[model samples]
Target chain A: MRELLRVAPGGAVDLGAVDPRSTPGLPGREVTGPQRKEWARGQLTLIGAELGRQQEMLFAEAKARQSAARPVGAAAGGGGSDAAAGGAGGRRVLLVLQAMDSGGKDGTVKRVAGAMNPLGLHVRSFGPPTPEELRHDFLWRIRRALPPPGYVGVFNRSHYEDVLVARVESLVPESIWQARYDEINAFEREQADAGVALVKVFLHISYAEQGRRLLERLDEPRKHWKYDPSDVDARARWDDYQAAYAEALGRCGTDAAPWYVVPADRKWYRDWAVAHLLRETFDTLDLGYPPAGFDVRRERERLLGSERTA
Target chain B: MRELLRVAPGGAVDLGAVDPRSTPGLPGREVTGPQRKEWARGQLTLIGAELGRQQEMLFAEAKARQSAARPVGAAAGGGGSDAAAGGAGGRRVLLVLQAMDSGGKDGTVKRVAGAMNPLGLHVRSFGPPTPEELRHDFLWRIRRALPPPGYVGVFNRSHYEDVLVARVESLVPESIWQARYDEINAFEREQADAGVALVKVFLHISYAEQGRRLLERLDEPRKHWKYDPSDVDARARWDDYQAAYAEALGRCGTDAAPWYVVPADRKWYRDWAVAHLLRETFDTLDLGYPPAGFDVRRERERLLGSERTA
Candidate 1:
């Protein structure tokens, strides 16, 4: 299941060759058409429930651990640092998603990730850099947004934009964007080392599919507000964008945090695949309900024998 | 419904006199026994669903507004200041819960507030301040935890602690805790002026209930982790604690952020009351789905003319 979508470390990736309509095999065989869509939807529902429960277990465990570890006189407000309150330092997941405009990043978060416990999930969509952000290192803001332990942090568009959009759009010098590839791989490796399970997903969609979606946003009354005229200009540079993405996937894919090019042409499939990938990520972790640590008989006696009673 | 539990601004409140077991009338006459518990449970379920949907509307509207208002080239990471991204400045909810040990603050959050979308909800359980925090005024940390627009922020235990625990425990001198009542009122008024719907709840549990719950924690192995030996010491000082709470509630309760003394002996009733109070708070606000704001005809033509399509 993990291997089906993973781009092996340093594996060469050609965006032009990988079909945007391809749906990876689930367990045994390849699923397609209506049957595949139905199967994916069912899997999504089941996985959504599982993700919710898993999050609860992690939260409870973290809360208990935090209670046990809090220093004396520490305030009881739930404003402690994420690492302290969340507990189990390395037990977190960061789903780094990179895709072109109209590639379903927002839709995937809304339809799939939205079903999970929002307390345990942090979905961050990156856009253009602010003046302050440009003044610092690119990864500074990314560091601030990393999911706290026991959480699943989704980066709607991640640091890869430094090498992809920055390269294709000439936002920075060639010397800078070209060097970002190494910096990104190292940064992700450090995250993986820290026990943050990194799942980098490239939502793969065709040129025509993007155009259609952009037009749909324009045509639909409710969605018109979401359509941006600037999106068309980006679409005009589609081939160049593809080449930039191809280089990124090939250069940055690593064993610690492999890139998965999910088919974004089909919304159902794309959502299901992303959800499935997330569930599998959780499956690999040692997550469960924490042990009960108090003396049951003595406490029950105390409750029953309390001098002052409700 | 709003009138049922609200403590009129500056109203005299005697903690010793307010029955912890008093159940306010929901609509009609008071209900009793098993029927009352069942009734509260039903309301809890219904209100939970409404809060969830209302949150979605706010989130969608905020997301749209943010996109429209984002300064070009804003940083792409998720760590931007909340005020900037969650536009409309004052469209947010902050529920502040202050209670004695085992007062069901955690339970109320889990059973009622937990049902809302976590994405739009910010739960901050304020603990003792860190050394750095102690250097600043008490309101410093409280201000840091205020939720941005389009979100519901819950302060498990709040600034009132400065007057409540700090007063009873004598952690601070009379000179300090004495002035906090006015400071607290001013801060809450500022929040209300900023458009934050503030509801302060004092989960009024009987002394006996606290003993029973404390013992339950000690007795139950799973809950043993939550039992603090110091809790018994606080229980011993119940009378002093109550006086502090009564004064805090009476003095700080204002038109902008009235305090509600909820009879919390019955877990079912407590959960329902908090959920109901939150729903009413939101009810007073003009929250709804934002209107669609894009060109329909132009977009429709673009979609029809796209050569490559989904």
Candidate 2:
């Protein structure tokens, strides 16, 4: 499944070659049309329920570890650099999503990641940088938004914009934006060392599809709020954006921080693929309920005994 | 519904008088037994979906308003006190849940709030305050975790802990904990003035039910992770905690932040009631999608025209 979507480290990606409408095969064979959509929905429902348990397991592990790290009578809440992270530390996962307008970044999150316990999930969307953000390094705000340990963080749009949109719109000078590819690489490397697993996804949608989506938003009174005129301006430079995306995806795709170009013309397939990829990531991590720090046998006696006392 | 559950301002609360197993009336009359559970489940599912839409509407409006508030060429991201809040502002909501151990707070979040978009929902669980957190006012950390506008925030445990556990366990001096009821009311009033709505809920359960839950946890290996020894200690003093809760609920039940005593003996009823309450909250807000900031007709032309150019 990953082989179809994942770009290898140092791999050259040609955005034009990949079919935006292509749906990857599920386990045994490719399920198509209505059946495929139904299969994906069923799988998503199951996956969502499992993800909820997985998150709680990780959270329990974090709490146990945090308690262990704290000195007795020193008071709860793990201290040190981790103090800022609300006494949580352990394995973390981040999902970075980049897409052209109406490429279903929001849809992917709502469908694929929505069912997970929000306590263990953090979703940060990056649009145009604020003036304060501009004053700092490109990765500054991204750093601030990174998920604390034992969390699954999703970025609707991310630092890739420093290279993609920055290059396409010439928001920053050529030299500065060009240097950012390596800066992002180094930044991601640090996160990886810090026990953060990265899943960078590009929801690949066609130009015509984006235009159709934009038009639909404009026509539907309920969706009018989502229709931005600037989206059209970006649509007009579709070729430039595509070129910029190809370069960014090609340059930033790494073993530690891989990029998956999910064909998003079909929203169902896009959602399924992302969920599948995320489940695969969790499968690799040794995630399960952490053992109780206290003696369970002793606790059981105390718990049952307290009933008599009450 | 509010009349049945709400603890009116300055009202006397007798925790012993209310039946933990009671289910409130629906619109007209109450549904009972299995049928009631099924009905609540169906209602919860429908309410969850609608809440998702309402949250998106509020988010859309917040974005629109934030952009409008910024000066031209301001380079997006609303600046000011709002800058730290991800540029989101509008109607905010806080749902604070309190209960004895095994009161099904986590279960309610899973069954009710699970369907909402994680991007717009923030859930914070307050355990024992950290050394640093204890150094400041009890409300400091609570204030930090308050949901920004356009977001629904859930607190698994909250400031009520100051009066409940602090008084029950004598963790703080009597004078300090006694004064917190007014302090909490003032804090919630400030939040109300800042366009925040508060729904403080106590998941009331019978002592026998809690014992049954604890024994189940003890018996099941998978559930052992959650069986803490301290929970038994807390359970031993159940009556004291109840008294503390009764006092806090009576005093802090302001016009702005009403406290609801949710009968949580039936897990299904507890989830259904909370979801219903949240839906009623959203219903009161003008939560349809915000109107487009730009000319929709002109954008529609530009969107259609882009297809030709592409």
Candidate 3:
């Protein structure tokens, strides 16, 4: 039953075809076809099931911890311990995106990132840079939203837009925006070296998909508020945006911060793929309880007695 | 250092003065001194750093369980499985307030409730109830937001307002609103009998405290967006609202959903007290991991390989 539910109709897309070198602007090109295919097929079920299992286990564990009744600081190392030492010694993740209206950013954040601990996860949606943000560098606002140690921070639409959308629409001079790709690569490299796991996903959907979603939003009364007519103008720049994405992905697709060209034509597959990738990233972390040997009984008893007295 | 932090100046209020036998409409003779003091102390530390430690532990446990990579059905019995099995076995805490405009609901939620899994924790902030909500019953919206099974659900403000604010402000007739106390008591008794842990905290603050907060909002540019002059009308009826709270708390104070009048004069103290109460409630659960003896390795290997052939 689980197997049947897990396997989607289209199956996993070829990651190599979506690779940067294969096809610059076009969507389809297969490199390392057989090997990548075999690898993806071999790992898909195990990875999916493992992700689901982890989510459930995490929920159960959180519930149990709530019931332990231990003094808060006692169970999680000593008081004043940094979060990193309290069993969350993992590479922090930061997700950056540059999406047009009805570009599925909200859905991506919810479906891809919803299961994460709200405490350890930060979602910052950058509307527009402030005057202060513009005074320094464009990356300043983005820098402020970076996740702390052992946390994941997601940007709904990110600094890439200073090059992508701004370039496409001539929002900034070509000279000013063109240099950002290298600057971005350097900035991401710094974060990677600083123990931040970066997985940049571009929800590569066709103009047709964007149109269908926009229409659906209009049809659904609940989503009607989200519809904007100006999105049509953005849609007209489809080729320009596609070229920009290809260039950005090509320039910034380092071993440190690889870009995944997600086939977001299928929302379920996109969600599953993102979840699988996140699980893989977190699995690489060596998170566990601190080595136990602390005597918390005295503190616990004292606190309880104080409670009773109060 | 921990002891000094724990024993900081604030302590729970005395509730001894509360008389269970007291009839409704009695002026301000609500809570007994001891109970009031205990309640006060509990609220003071609801979101203190101590509580933050507990939250971190819960998340850490969840992360560990997830990392172990067990099967979903069986993994539910992993670390902290006791909470899953307990299934609504502890006290149901409900926090009530007038308006959370800037009354620290988000801060409280993050500090006190951020640690628990979303599955076992729920928050429902009642804005103007939908037409559908009002059409059914006053308690309809409130009941819908109650925590399921073994979990905690916090109400920014609660059903008491239908009587307190609506009565004092003449939003509803006195005869109609007055009868809600018995209805609420009966409802709470039903929850208590079913092992629902019920805690009601009225975050009390003087008009001066509120005025100071409002002034801060106006002074700070970032917070300017949050201020609403409409709050002055609510502040004008401060004395009337207090009388209503005193009456309602006195009448509805039961073993099931006991009202704890917390002093919100100090934000730190309130956060600490809430966390303390929550910790106390969960400690009573005696939760632990379920018995585990399942072979997951074989299944994992099989699943990993099956996708290749498909």
Best by TM-score: 2
Q: What is the lDDT of residue A2 in candidate 1?
A: 62
Candidate 2 vs. truth: CA RMSD?
A: 3.2
DockQ, per model, reads: 0.26, 0.41, 0.03
Candidate that scores best on lDDT: 2
Which digits, one per residue and each the tens of the lDDT, describe model 2 over residues B101-144?
A: 89988788777778798777777777777778889999988887
Say which docking band candidate 1 falls in: acceptable
Question: Per-residue lDDT tens digits of candidate 3, residues A1-310?
Answer: 1121121222233333542222232212442444543444344445545543443333223222322334432221111112212222235667665455665666666545544534344455554344466688888767765665545667777777677767877767999888898798899888888777776777666555666676665445444334333344556666677777667777777777776665666554555556666676656654332222222343233323322111
Residue A21, model 2, lDDT? 89
Chain B of candidate 2 vs. true chain B, TM: 0.92
Candidate 2 or 3, higher TM-score? 2
Any runs in candidate 2 off by more than 4 Å, and if so which?
Answer: A27-30, A72-88, A308-310, B26-30, B71-89
Against the native chain B, each candidate's TM-score is 0.91, 0.92, 0.66
lDDT of 1 by residue, B1-310 (tens): 5687777667558777778887775544666567877887888889989988776666656656766676654423222223324334646788888888889887786677666865466666666665666889999878876777777888778888788777877788999998888888888888888878898999999887887777766655555545654565576677888888878888888888889889899898788889888888878885776665445676456555545543
Query: By summed lDDT, which 10 consecutive residues of candidate 3 chain B come out lowest?
Result: B1-10
TM-score of chain A of each: 0.90, 0.93, 0.69
DockQ winner among the candidates?
2
Error of 3 at A98 (Å): 4.1
For candidate 3, the per-residue lDDT at B12 reads 29
Interface RMSD of each: 5.2, 4.9, 22.9
lDDT of each: 0.73, 0.78, 0.52
